[model samples]
Target: MSGLRERKKERTRQALSDIAVALFLEKGFDAVSVAEVAAAAEVSKPTLFRYFPAKEDLVLHRFADHEDEPARVVAAAREAGAVPLDALRDHVLAGLERRDPVTGLNDDPRVLAFLRLLYGTPALVARMHAYQGRSEELLADALGGADPLAARLAAAQVVAVLRVLAEENVRRITAGERVEEVLPGAVAATRRAFAGLGEGLSSFC
Candidate 1:
């Protein structure tokens, strides 16, 4: 049936990423070839390309699920008659509490290795920036399509705040702090950051 076929395809996709990441970590991102990843995953180079269009995708594809998450949060917030900023704040707090990998709070060995691969690879970093750009566009559309500049500026500020917080979480965890130890600080930081966003900074001068 269609459902079974979809599950099988998902398994193959996941296997490819798992093999690719393992190999990339073992060696290095630029040093590894798409053909080699295909060989390790027991698929042809063309088939691997069919699943992931580029070499960078072999690693960044792990983020495919959360690619449009911020946009979705914005949309859902509007539907519920709530402001996007509040929704974003709550969503981020939940991720921190759960230590979501996307939030960079997970300290699993594999996750640490994967983060190293991403941060150390220039190609992956560039590709990640492209992804973030697209995310900002989607969020801008959700916020308002009338004024592109305003929407984009708002999205950029929001995304930048969350990205820094997540990276800081990764840094502390890598330095041996447990998620529990970081959660309180993360919660306080989120509240303060969002509050600053809600209140204009003109008076600070």
Candidate 2:
């Protein structure tokens, strides 16, 4: 029964987010109101608030699934007796090959529009920083070691490198470059970025 209830809640949350994003994309983020999103989703403002406490969350929920991805990758690497940094680099390279939106290598029109909306909105950008901070914390926890501070610093660097790489990919794609054209450079950049990290973090984790 509890599982069923959770499933229903997830569906409701996804539905509301879908409705809110469509409305925001059509009318612009600042132009739309929480009240309007709630109405469009056919729920009262209170109910929408129950699911997403902030208006920004209506859009940012799209990233909720990926918040722990870096941490998970590190954990999996440890379990498999692989270097954490290498695992993360491979994971990102694979994402680029598949044009994962999180890697910002996707050129889908809808994804491009969504990226524009996310980066163009100051509030959304600020909130995204908060999300990155959380990712850093999670990765730090996963990279646990005797020197806690070192783990945290390493995590911060890793998260920042990944974010910058993704941003660059998005920039090129949005500037009208084809994903295939950007693939080699993107792959090379990722390797260089991770190689830099390996200089200090290879043995730390």
Candidate 3:
């Protein structure tokens, strides 16, 4: 089932990613070059290329699975006669309770540093914008292909609010606020953000 070539490739990819994150924290992401990452990971340039198509892949790969989360939440709720907004709101709140990183629940110093790295690096920000577009596309498709207008509008609003909430969480975290201290604000802010869609979400709540 598992070929030697594939297994070795996976190992090399992980090694490179591990080394890259460490270097990124130690020296800044923009300052680190592919060559340095390869050397630091004990991998050749071509080998690194085979593993990660580009330098951005190192950080982005971690976010790949999360790209589908919004869509998955919507789809799951639809089968139960729930609107997309209701579905997504429930998913967000549930994630908060679980202290999921995607919900910004674990915004400790290391996580805040990672957020700073993404914000400070121009290329990473550009890639992140691209990823946001993909997330919208996924949600739109999940919301029934009949009318894209509704899906697009809902996805845009939901994502905008979610991003703002996440940013605020990181802000509080960086300012030395604990998770418990920041949660009430986060919850209230989230409710306010979803207030316009009260009919659908209130029923779910």
Top candidate, metric TM-score: 2
Tens-digit lDDT track of model 3 for 11-121 = 767767778988998999888999999898877889888888889878776677888788888887877877667667667787777767666667666766777776668
* Worst ten in a row by lDDT for model 3: 196-205
Runs in model 2 lying further than 4 Å from the true structure: none
Off by over 4 Å in 3: 2-12, 197-205
Ranking by lDDT: 2, 1, 3
For this target, which candidate reaches the highest lDDT against the unseen true structure? 2
Q: Per-candidate TM vs. native? A: 0.88, 0.98, 0.84
Which pairs clash inside model 1?
none
Model 1 residue 106 lDDT?
80
Better of 1 and 2 by lDDT: 2
lDDT of candidate 2 over 88-110, digit per residue (tens) = 99999999988899999989999
Model 2 global lDDT (CA atoms, 0 to 1):
0.93
The stretch of ten residues in a row with the least summed lDDT in candidate 2 is: 196-205
What's the CA error at residue 83 for candidate 3, in Å? 3.3
Compute the lDDT of residue 140 as modeled in candidate 2: 95
Between 2 and 3, whose lDDT is larger? 2
